[model samples]
Structure formats: C-alpha cells, structure tokens
Target chain A: MNSNITHDLAVPLNQEDKAKRAFVTALRVHVLQHMSGSMKNRYEDYVKPEAQKRGNTCDTPEHIHKALKSDFMFKAYSSARTCAQEMVFDVVSDSVDREFETLRAKAKPVAKKGSLTLDDSVEIPKSVSEIDVHLAPGSYHAEYTEEDFATGAVYDNAIEVFSFGQFGKDSNDIGMTLSNYVRLKFPDFKPAKILDAGCTIGHNTLPWAQTFPEAEVTAIDVAAPVLRYGHARAESMGVPVHFRQMDATAMKFEDNTFDVVFSSMFLHELPLKDIHAYLKEAYRVLKPGGLLWQMELPPMNQMPAYDNFYLNWDTYYNNEPFYGTFRRQDYRKLLTDAGFGAEEFMEATMPRYTFVGEEAYKEALSGENTFDTLTGRMDPKGTRWYGFGAWKK
Target chain B: MRRIPRKRRGERNRFFQAEGVDELLSALLRLSAEVSALKDRVYIAEKVLEQQGLNVSDAIEAYELSAEQEAELAANRQRMIETVLAQFDNSSDVDDMTDENSKIEAAA
Candidate 1:
C-alpha cells in the first residue's frame, strides 16, 4: 500500500466540476453518518458478516429471496426507503445522469480521441436473450425466442441500479466520475474501439460514451436482463453503443478489434477460469497497440492492513468467490503476459468535494490546487474505491 | 377461514443468534453442519431409491423389515454408492455431504 497516489496532471480540475464531486462526497458521508439505527444495524449485523464471507453460504440468491420474504426487520426499511425509488439501481443512475447533464449543459464537450472496433473472439448467442438467467423469470428473454426485444418490452429496469449498489462505492457513479476525470487528464488518449465487459445495465458504459463520443463503445454481458436494460438506457440517454448478449470470454468480434477494452467491477464476479479466458480475450481482441484497464477493488498489495482485512471481507464470506484472488493478483504481470505494454497502475482519490471546506478547490482555478489538497467530498460521494488498468500504446 | 400462512424456517436464525445463547448457537451451527451432511447422504439414498424403482414407502419397508432385510438394504446402499461414486467421485453430491459431516464432527 505504498502511496503511489501522485497527481502531477498538466491541467487541473476547475471550480464547478469540483463542486459537483463534493456533492456526491457529502452524500456518502451523509449516508454513513446519518443512516438510521435500523440501517446501521442492517450493515453491522447482516451486511458486515455477509460481506466478510464474500457472499458465501448466506449470500446465495436464495438467501436474498429468503431475506426478502422473512427478514421482517431487514425489509422494513428497505421497503420503506425503496418504494418510490428502485433501490440502488435507479438512484445512482439518476445521480450520474444528473452530473453528466450538468457537464453537457455547461458546454464542457467531453474530448474524444480514438475510433472503436468489435472484439472478434466473442459471439452473441441467438438464445442468449431468451433463457431466464438465474430463474429471474423474464430478465434475459431473447428476441428470436419471444419477440420481446422487438416489442420493446424490457424487464427489471431497477435491477441494474439495485445490484450495482450492492457494489457499494464500487458503484458505477464513482467509476464514471473518475473515468471522465481520466479522459480530461489524457484528452489525446482515446482508443479506436472500447469494450465494457460484464456490463450490467451499461451505467459504466454510458460514461465511456460521454468520454469518447466517436469511439464505438461496446458493452457485453452474459446476463440478458441487464444487457436489455443497458440497451434501453443507452437508447433513452441518446448515447448509441452496440449492446449485445455475449460472454466477455468468447466475444465474436475480431482479434485486434478494439484499441481499449475495459471493465468496471467485473473481474471479481468471474470464476478463475473465466478470468483467464477474459484476460486472453482482452489480449486477443486488442489491436497491437491497445489498452486493457479495469476499475477493481483495491488489490491487497496496494492497501493497508485493516483495508486488506476489510477488502477480503468478501473473499472470506461474501459469495464473491474471486475477490481475494483479484485483490492478490499482479495486474502488471497479467498484462505483460497478455502482451501489453509497460502498464501504469496508480490509484486516484478525488477530493470528496471540489474543496468545499478547504481553499484548495477554490484556489484550484487560481493555479494553487496541490495533489494532496484534502477537501471533503460534497456529500455521500466517498471515493474510498480505487481504479487500476494497463496500457498497450 | 383464512390463516396467516406460516413461514418455512421462520426467524429461528435470529433466535439462535440472540444473546445469552452462545453455547446454543454453537450447538445449532454444529448440528446444522451435521444435518447438511446427512442431507447429502439422504440425497444419494433417495437417488438409490429412484434407481431401484423403490418409492419412499418401499425404501422404508426394506430399511425396517428385519435384521436380515436391514443388512440387505445396507449392502444395496453401499453397492449403489460405490457405483455412483465411481461414476462421479468428484461430484459434490457425496462430498458436499461429507464436508458438512466433517465440520460437525470437528465442532463436536
């Protein structure tokens, strides 16, 4: 956990942009500080140990089914708090959209650089959109099988947001914010083709679209519900990227199709076999000069003691079978073996706020914001989560 | 006569995790492990019943008929397991049961 967190970016973030970030930061603190007793109890009692187990025995989909049915106290708040909104699924979607809308309205045209191509090794099964994955009844129903796709009848609109929230700060909101921040940092560094593997609902995919307007951003997932939701979302947002019901491992696109293939919080859900396949697929699909970066849980090697224990909470207990493996893996080695260039792996923590309390943010525009300008995030936007990836160009 | 349909498995977990019952909780967890293993064995035995075309009633009768009959049933189970395990030794159907059994034994 050596602090390789250095920011000597040639250009700096501005006043208004910093303010939007702080709002989310304050929101995170708001939730953490002011979560009701029942909510607090939910985490300390059920969620904490559950996370500790990495969604293990107590974390089966059946467990969720059971909890939804019988855990009276647990559901009391969930039902109350979640009635109007569709849990984490919709709330963060709204927030990210709102933030981005602000960006677009202000004429901060997201700078773009490269073109995009499809990954050839992957194929979309005709029946992929048909079978009800994990027995959710209708989420993954295919077009040819049911004519549901053409009818425009999509299912589980909120599931994408709800389940993503289960990702906590690994939330799509944080990924989009920081990813866009990266775009701003390297405006000239756009890839021809982009991929979002394990894209559930395409929230993270949307950010790439915002960042690289010209790139043919492709999002692929094995699950049909989220992919359908993502397709619908992209259409609704007026951001067109090819959304397909395809596995991240054996994508149908050609080799060297994309200049950049990235995933957000996707690698950990895969079994070890699939992870290898994905890495291979990533390598196979990327052009001779391409980049493969993923935003993932802080590797155990990159974090402190309590954080190791904290992050490994899932591996030990949560049903996330690969959390520990991913945290312990060497991305640089993984990339080099995959035939990528010397990788840049650094973690970035945005000031919770632009600099609400501190003079750093206000002073940022005045050319005085230091890398360590410790400003609190606006509200609940605690960017405790970290980002990592490798480059080929 | 509308009854509030009772829940299966209910809130017993909460009861076990409650205060002043550390030993009880430990024993329950240990027993759960035991039962979970027994379930695997039960699953295999049920499969045996299916293979033998013996329903639950027939299996019970064979298991209960006399000392000799009981021994015969036991032998049949062992043979069935041998065959099935050979075909799928790596299957969790048997080992999942055994893992839970071992946990129970260790706990006890």
Candidate 2:
C-alpha cells in the first residue's frame, strides 16, 4: 500500500504521480530485499572463496566493499538503488512545485497552544548547506522564497515513499518506538519539559508530545521552512509543539532547561566534531537527573563485519557522508565525553511500538540486540530499534 | 516563477565499469517509470469514463482528432519526448525547464 502524507501542507498528486511513487517504492523494496540477497549469494559463492585464496578474510567493511566493487550483481544492485533514491525526490518535486504557493499559504501558523521562533541569524551549517544529504535535491535548509515551506513538504511527502511503510503510518515510528521505550523502561521518570534537536518537520517530535501529554515539548531545526511547516502540522493535528529554527550545536535555549533532550536518526547527518558539539549542547541544556535519549542505528562495534558493511552502505552510495564515521565511534565514550557518567549510560533494543502492540513491545525490551545481515535494514525481520542514553548527574 | 530543482546537486556515481552502461540503466529505469505512470493515467481515465456510463473503449477507438486537436497533441508529444531525453543533456537545468513549462501551462 502506498502511504501518502495527509497533513494540511501535503501536496496534491495526480494519478500518474501516485503511480510513479508506488513504482519507486516497489523498486526500492525489490532492490533492498531481492537484489541484496543475490549480492550476498554472489559474495558467498564466488567473492569469499577468491578472497580466501588471496589470504584475505574480508572481515572488515572496507574489505567487503572492495571485494564487492567488481561484482556484477553488486554493481546492478547499487545502480538500481541509487536510481530509486533519486526518483523518490524527483517524483514528488513536481507536485510540490505546482502547489508551492498554496502550501506556503497553508503553512501560516494557526496554533493556539504552541509558537514558532525563527532565528534569522542562525547560520546553516556546511554539512546541511553544502550536501544534499540523501540525494534530496535541496537538502533540509533551502529556501525558494520568503517563508518558503517547499523543502519541508517535499520531505514529508517523499519520506513515506522512501521508507516503504517501515516508518509507520505517519512516518513517526522512530519517535513512537523510542518514546514508548523510555516511558516503559523508566516508569518513575516523569519529564515536564522535553527538547527534540534537529527535528525536521517534527515527524519524530510529535510522538513525544503524544506519549507524555503533560510535557511541554519543544523541537528545533536550523531550517525555518521545516520549522514553519512542522508548526502548522502539529497545530492541525491538535498537538501543541513549540517549533524553533536553531542549530543543535549552538542552541539558543539556556543551560539546564529541559527535563529530556531527545533526537532520532539525527546524529548521523553531522560531522564527528559537530556530533560531539551537539551532544555537549544536549548535556548542557538538559536539567540535572534528566535523560539524554536518542534512537539510531547500532554502533559498528555491536555488529559483525558483514552487518557493518550492509548498514554503512549509505556512507558509500547514499549522500550521508558522516554515517559510517558516526557509527564507528564508541557510543559509551560519546556520552561520557559529553559529561555523562559511564555508569549512567544505558542502551536498549526494543521492538517497534506501532508494529508489535504495547504488551509485545514491553516483553521484547528484555530481549538482547540481534545482529545479522538485516540488523539496521528495512526488512521485516529487523523490527527492533536501537536506542542509547545517559542520565544527567 | 521560481521552480524547485528536481535534480540533486552532487557527483553522480557510475556503478558499471563499461562506458554508457550506467547511463543506459538510468534511461531504462526512467522509461519504465514513465510507462508505469502512463498506464496508471490511462487506467484512471478509462475507469472514470466507465463510471459516467460512457463506453470508453469503443469511443476511444472510434474517435478522430480535429486539426487543432491533432496539432496540440503533436506539440504535447514533442514536449514529452524532450522531457524524457533532457537527462542526456547535462547543461539543461531541470529547474529552468520546469519554470518554462509552468509559463507555458499558465499561458494555456
């Protein structure tokens, strides 16, 4: 089933556009499932034995990448995957462009509960400005006109097609799974104020508001267009979430302000230094005894070489330049370096809350992290979401 | 009017070692997508006409375009061809073409 965005700012796509999106989604799934399996079979049948003859075990990600470089199956898989990635944005861009003015007008804030704060002086980091970051054409921060929300609309619409139903109905599975994990895992930790950093369109941010209805939720991104669009989206859904255009590395909020600082699939988009900077900022803004929680792909150390290579495919083929680098870092060291004690650091792999019901999810939390070829993949088998956090002193 | 660029900014990776193989693959995929889109549009048109109590298949087969209609359809076909082939011309900016098309659409 094709999952289309139903928000107020959603672009109206014609039948052909919908078909194109559906085709792209199917193509991506086919590549990820069938082609990936074929590539692995070719590796096991031919590439591995050849490497063994050359005295190379092909144990590292770099080795696996190099070994697969000349393989025809790998080449076909990579090319098709790249084409589908580009087409995801291309198929949705025309509809968004046609309704750009209407979407901009619709994005006007009507929220009675929350507010939008755009900082004109907030510099767009080179990581976002220079690269398209997932081959998404304009990246996250591009502005076509005054108060333009086209980028946000494009992202919100295309993500459903891109994720291929892995991100739940509203593309908020990451937030839903993580927030539920936090709430269930730490039953006594009641947060009154929450902050979501690098919250593009607030897809993941809204779940926090839903999970903890009493918490005053605030979300920040460097892009004004996305913040504006996100504000309108939250308001239309009757979920009050304060949206702000502020860099995560240098947030405008005062120190020790939030009871919970949250992020999901956000850290891999930044450079290693920026990741460190953002974590330190998260540490500073979080109140004492607060939690710094994030949902991300498991670290490289937690997986074997093949799984690492499979997960880091985005680093080589996709536009995520920092993906592999971020994964290679020691998760424990990252939190500890940012002032959280090593003893207070926590990690968990929980089943998707939306997929498996609450009871099944709660039961699955005690399960160990499963590492295989599909650990961080979009396959049905990889239903687990990895999260780690540390409690402030 | 300003148009958003459909083409992403970056160096495109060539997966195949053979010359023109990657380009051929891209063109083939584009063709497949276009074919799929066209099939869907035709299906929707047929269904809508059928729901209106019109015999779409018979009417479509029996109908003949007027001179002006034929000319318009010819121009649309040419535009579609150009749109499909524009990928080969690296100098052609998709945003610019989209802007020009929007101007034409507005004029129409």
Candidate 3:
C-alpha cells in the first residue's frame, strides 16, 4: 500500500555531500566506539582514583564533570563529537541549499490531501531560538526564504547521519516503537485523533498515521521550515498528517480534543518551566481517558550518578541547556500536578524498533525481554527509548 | 592585513567551548581522504588498463612479486575484509533497503 506522493525519502545529494555523509557516518561510529571508550577508561583509571584520593565523592554529576573535564581523552571525545555533530549538518546543508529554489517550488504546491497551516504570529520560544540546539546552524525555526524548508531538510538528513542508521534508516524509530508499544500493551485502546507535539519534520508522526489508519493524525511544531518540510515529506510518503506551526506550551486546540497526545525527543529541548507548561497544555487538550505519552531521554533518577553525569554532558557542552534540569525532575509528580491521577501514571522503556527486530519487539510488548532495567546504562548498540505518561481521567 | 579569506574557516562547536581538537581532526581527515582517493584512482586505473589488454605491472616494470609477498598481501586483504568490509557490508544492506523505499517514494 504505497501512498503516491512527491519527494524521495532518501534526499537528493550531490557527489561531494555523498562522500561527506559517508565520512561523517564513519566518524560517528569511530567517536562513539573508540573515542568514547577511551574517555570512559580515562575516567575510571585516572580521574576517579584522583578524586577518591582527594576525599571527594565522585558520584554527583558536578564531581564527575570536575574530575573528567581536564582529561585530554575526554576533551578529544567532546571536541570530536561536537565537530561530528556540526559536520552532519554541514554535509547535508549544501545539497539542500543547492536545490533550495526548486525544492521550495515543488513543495509549495504538493497538492496532497494533507494540509499545512503556518501561523506567523506564533513566537519562537527562547529555548529554541536563543541557542542553536544540537549546534545546527540557524536553528529549526529560522526561515531564509518565503518558501523555505531547508532547515527541516537539513535536520532530516543530519539526523540520518547522526544516528548511524540506528533510527530505522528514515529516523522514525521513536515514533514507530512507542506507537507499537501502545498498540500491543493497550490492545483495547484505539485513539481516534492523535497529536504529536514538537514533531520536527514529522519523522515520528507518520508512524501513528500508519499504525492507526482510522485516526486523523495531527503534528505541530513552532518551526515553519520543519512544518512545511514535514507536510511535504508526509505527503510524499502518502501519509495524511495535518502539520501546523503552533506553540506546544499553549496550543490553540479546544479542551478534550485528541485521544492520544504524544511527543518524542522533544521535552528536553524546553526549559523546566516550559516542560510544566507543555504538560499542562497536554492535559488541557486531552479528552477524558485520553493518553498523554512522551518519549524522551530517561530521567536522571532512573540512572546511577555516573550515568547521570555521562548523560548530562549534553546539558553543559552539547547546547541542550535544560537536559540536566529536565531529567532531574520527578516526572510522576509533574503528571499528577498536570491533573493526571497518580494511579494513571506509567513509565516504561521500549527497545528502539531499529535495533531489535519485530520478534523481540513483540516479546518486549508481552512483558518479556524488557530493557527497562538497563536504562541506567545508555547503550547505543542496545538502543532503548524511555517513555512516561498518564491517562487523563 | 588579511585581505583574502582562507578556504577553510575553522568552525567551533558552541558546546565544547574549546578549539584545536576539531581542527586537528579536520586536518587529518583531509589527508585521509586524499589517501583514499589515490587508492581509488589506482584501482580505477588498474581496471581500465585490464580492459585495454595492458596490465599495470607490464607498464610499470616494477620488481617481481615473491610468493611470500603475494601470501602476505592476500592475508592483509583477508584481514581488511574481516575488519572493515564486514561492518560496511552489513550497513549497506540496510542502506539498500532505505534506497529501495526512497525509489518507491520517488516513483509514487
């Protein structure tokens, strides 16, 4: 059942970008495997022992960071990772930039049944606008042209390279895995209207539409470029998704709307205050007995202190300012405060659909071969996404 | 004093908040790419010469390869296949699937 639409899932890249993308892909593997291991060994062998000799408990993120920051291996890994992150964008940016005019023209009149509604008045939040999240130049919302979709294209291609093909080739694992989990676990629950908040380029958004064909799926993001690109991408894939540029903090939807309000890899991008606001908005928009699930980085409380520090490296050095703060929050309390009862709240881990095949995924769904306990140790090879939410009753 | 802009403007990572490391990596990458490109060209040239009924060894007139040299090179090739080609070959299968999907999308 191939939906007929425009555009290719594998973006059109010239020879140079192709080579650069390959280089970036190999470099990511090298950095993650070799360089990351060296850095960890340095911490274990030298940094931790030095801290212990100094009579300091090197358990907290601050203590760990203090001990590891000056280490050369740590510096090399950090720098290489940062460069690789930026290179992911740089390699793809050229291809998108080269075809900007033609791509925009082609996208504007895609003529798919799915719609794209952009509200120019929506203010770009400081968390996204102030810092170039993930060191991506021009951030997500910045529009260089009247019909610009380059930022979204940049992100789409960049993420494919960054994940090293772990995000199910097209970077839809988060959405597909979570949606599949919901389907298997709550077999009786059928969402009529599904909403994906902060859906960048709608990579995760399409899975819901495919998973629940009867449901009318809507995905919203503040970035016009991503929204525009997402709409075209969805149309090209023949998935009908209504993509709108709207603030997640204060959505324009009426009360008791969507049956399933979901987000993926989005909450960490917002400040702690905005996270609360977003949760409240999620509560406001969700109908009675509706599900509000968020798939994001595992909270700090779930992991050991060393793992917390290791994960929080992004907060201090990866341009994600609120990552550390958001992870430390008690999510169960946040859900309860947002009008969800304590009994309704649930937190679980699902293996990324990209790494584990359908059989293991089914095993995970049936409460067998679960990876929730291993959430403390973040493993790229054995990838698992952490999710938490509550039913609005 | 500097009038013309340099070809490679060193870009810094905002998060790392440091320099030199990324710059060094980039520098090394350029040399690595050059080496790889040269190797690629030699393979291409070998193929072209083979098709033209002119062997590269015949043209070059280099020292004769000993049986020991041949065995060592074969061993090196085997090791490379196990180490490098094995990982990439697996990834390429997934990549091919993605490409097929993209082709379908394009056709649609």
Candidate 4:
C-alpha cells in the first residue's frame, strides 16, 4: 500500500489525543484479556461447583447468569467491560470533537462523488435507534446536522481501539479474509456487481471492490453519517465504492441485480425477525447462482455449551440484545428456510492471517483445513474467521 | 485545557451498577494526555538544546537529586508504554494463566 493512501485513510489526531487513544486501546485489551480470564476462573472455581452441588444444571446461559451475575468477580468483569466500552467512545469522540467542523466540511465534497448516493427518507428501525449498538454512544445513524459524519469517525477510531489492531491496519481483515475464501472456493466465478449490506464505514466494503476492481461495488446502510463518512473514507483511500443510505431489510435494488451479497459481523446486531427479512432480501437481490456470504459469530448449537454461555455475555450485559438469539439459530437451516437448498449452504472458519501463519493460510485456502467443533468459538484476540451462507440457484 | 465534547445525548449503559468509574477513567486519560504533552515539550526542548551544543547531563550533574527525588523522576520519566504494560506484568490473573497453573485446556 502507498504510504500516502494509508496516511490519508487514517483518522487524524494530534500528539496528546494519540497518546490518550493508545492508552484507552491498551486498557480495553487488558480488561478483555486478563480480567476475562479471572472471570472464567471464578466461574469454574466457585459458581459452577456451587450450582452443581445445589442440584441445578449449569449448562445454559440462564443458569450461568443466575449463579454468577451477583458474584463479585462477575460484577468486576462486567464493570470493567462496560467501562472500557464507554471509554472507547469517550476517547474517540474527544479526539474527533475538536475537528468536528473540518470533518463535516470534508464529507460534503465526498458525497458529491458520482458513485455516492444518499436518501433522506430512509427509515432507521428501533432496533438500531432504541439502543446504542455495541454500546457505542449515538449508535451508527445519528446525525447532529446536515452532512454530519461524526458517528462514523467515532466508530472508525473506536473499532481500532476495540479490536486492538487485529482487524488489519485499516480494519479491513474481515473483508479481505472473506473475499480470499470466495476466490479460492469458486475459482471460475466472476462477480460483476456486488452488494454489501449494513456496511457501516465501508471498511469491509473496500476489500471486495479491490479484489474485483472490474466489478462495481455498492454498499448500503441506513445510517447517513456512516455512508457519508464511508464515501469520504473510500475516496481518501482512492478506492471507488458506491455508498447509499438504505435499509438492509428492505433494499430498493431491483431483483436479480447483484452478483454477490455479503455482510460482516452485521446480522447479530439485528432483531431475529429483521434477520430473516434481511436474509430473504439478500436471496432476492442476488442473481441466480450468485453467492451470499455472511461473516458472523459462530452458531451457538455448534459450540460446546460452556463456550456458548461465555460468548453470550454480550447479549445479556453489553446491550447487544439479539446476539444470543442469532447465534442459537442453525445458519444452514436459516439459509435453507430463506429459499436456498441444503446442498447450496456452506459454512467454514476462514483462516485469519493475523493469527494463522502464512503457510496455514495458504493450506486452508486449498481446502486442507480441518474445522473442529471449537473452531469459530475461540477468543477474538486469537485468529479464525467464522462465516456461513448459501448460493442462490 | 481543551474542552472535549460531552458524550452524545440519550442512552446510558443499563448494565453498570455504579457511576464514577467512567468519570475516573476519563480523568485518568486526560491526565495521561497532559503528561504526554509535557513529554513532547521536553523532547523538543532537549533537541533544541542539543542543536545549540548544550548537554542536559551538565544541569543534572550540577544539582544531584535526593534519593526520593531520583525515584520520583525515574517513575515520571519512564516510557509511557512501559508504565502502561507494567500494570499487566503485575496482574495476578495473567500470572495464573501460565501453562502449569491453567485449569482449563486452551481453546482449540
């Protein structure tokens, strides 16, 4: 990558703000790693044994919560996690707040690009508006004024802080990993039109456009702020991506218009009904034999019961209400229900290059990878990308 | 002394049992930012002094610090990254996760 493109694509912060951002990011990593380990130890050492002795099954999320929520270890873990979540917004928002006028001004010209589109009348469902998704303040869609992109700027910085730099330098790993798998899986397929649903900042959207430069990439989100910011982000990086403010559940695109439909870590944020609607819509938009891939959390049923309980903490305590419900559904069954047959559905844990060695990545691409039951349920700090979807035929 | 923007209006964390932790975290971050600013200023001052062919070590030699002052200076002048990481090094939770002590098998 050109140094200039990489520099321009980064969110700018002065010396002091940069230090604060780095501290907050480090703090988040510490809490998630050390503190999380302590929580698990406490559960195993005390809560589980006590519950089992009391003749209660400690296998389900409800049982675990009942036995552990009041424990001091759980409380500390919850507080630290909540504090880290809130502080991420504080750090990023503080860094960006000083240059709010400048960023808002920068967004205007970017939206004027012929490839960018904004619809003022798009509806933001309550599932998005009623709560801050991922505990982010103001969620993704709120705009303080016309052409405001502050929410997107905050998210772009916060995710980097939250991911601890594991999401690639530009946080484009999810897109890059998924696109690589698509090419390796179907070597002959050439998608001419790709649609990325619920593309917040087009971080993942840019990879598909880069992988298939000849193809036209169109990314849609209901959030105007992110769409505006994503357009500017893509422009700054010199990647041509068409961004639109549109709902994923009911996209305005014509049927059989897209050659590929995809999303990354997007479905679990939505309510169950909306997820089904979105899946049906994704099936409707893709052309016959076009691929529909979703990079998401591992399905709950596929994991050991303890891993399921561990990953479901966010659903209960982090304000991600729909996460548990979404993970519990069989992804293959969901796709088959959405009109694709069982044979058309495929699921795999893609090799995360940042975690896996170069040789392992290449081997996995060649279909030499073995996915055990615990493949996708591992820690985020480690490698492996969980994905599942179906082909429209 | 800069006035950072207040958090966005509406919606608070429903999970937290207490309030002051977020404020404390924010205050610590601001303090870190101020310390970083001072460090940057000191770095530039040192560079400029060096350019003028002056050595900072001469000033330190002229006024030797008491043991207490030396320790305080050492703590204050530690690299920001080292100071941050020292917390992790001191953590009991991290120590207990060693291969010999770990109770559960590592994630597959």
Q: What's each prediction's TM-score?
A: 0.47, 0.86, 0.80, 0.81
lDDT for model 2 comes to 0.82
Per-residue lDDT of model 4, residues A1-393, tens digit only: 011115243556654455466566656666666666767777888888998998869888778887887676666566656766777788778767777776655665533332678898998899888877777766778877666788888888877877777677688888988887787678799999999999999999998988888889999999888887888888877788899889999989999999899999899999989999999999999999899999998887667666677778889766789999998898888898788889998887877764564577768776743444345543445657888888899
Rank candidates, DockQ, best first.
2, 4, 3, 1
The global Cα lDDT (0 to 1) of model 4 is: 0.74
* Runs off by more than 4 Å, candidate 3: A1-9, A368-380, B1-22, B30-108
**Candidate 1 lDDT over residue span A142-259, tens digit each:** 3322212311122222232223232222224544544564565566877667888877656677767777777788888765534544564455556767777678778787988987
- Residue A147, candidate 4: how far off, in angstroms? 0.9
Worst lDDT run of 10 residues, candidate 3 chain A, spans A1-10
Tens-place lDDT per residue, model 3, A1-393, is: 011122564455543455466667766776666566666777888889998898868988888988887776676677667766777777677777766665665566456868999999999998888777887776778877676787887788777777777677467888998898888889999999999999989999999998899999999999898898888888877899999989999999999999999999888888988988999999999999899999988887767777778778888766888988888889899898888999998888777765687788888766633334345233455567788999999
Model 4 lDDT per residue over B1-108, tens place: 223334544555443356764455445444566576777888788788989998774573355456786556544433342343333233364455444234445443
- What is the C-alpha lDDT profile of model 2 across A205-240, one tens digit per residue? 999999999999999999988888888888877788
Docking class of 1: incorrect
For model 3, the local distance difference test gives 0.75
- Predicted complexes: DockQ each: 0.01, 0.20, 0.07, 0.13
When 3 and 4 are scored with DockQ, the better candidate is: 4
The worst-scoring run of ten residues by lDDT in candidate 1 chain B lies at B1-10
Model 3 error, position A24 (Å): 0.7
Fnat per model, in the order given?
0.00, 0.47, 0.06, 0.12
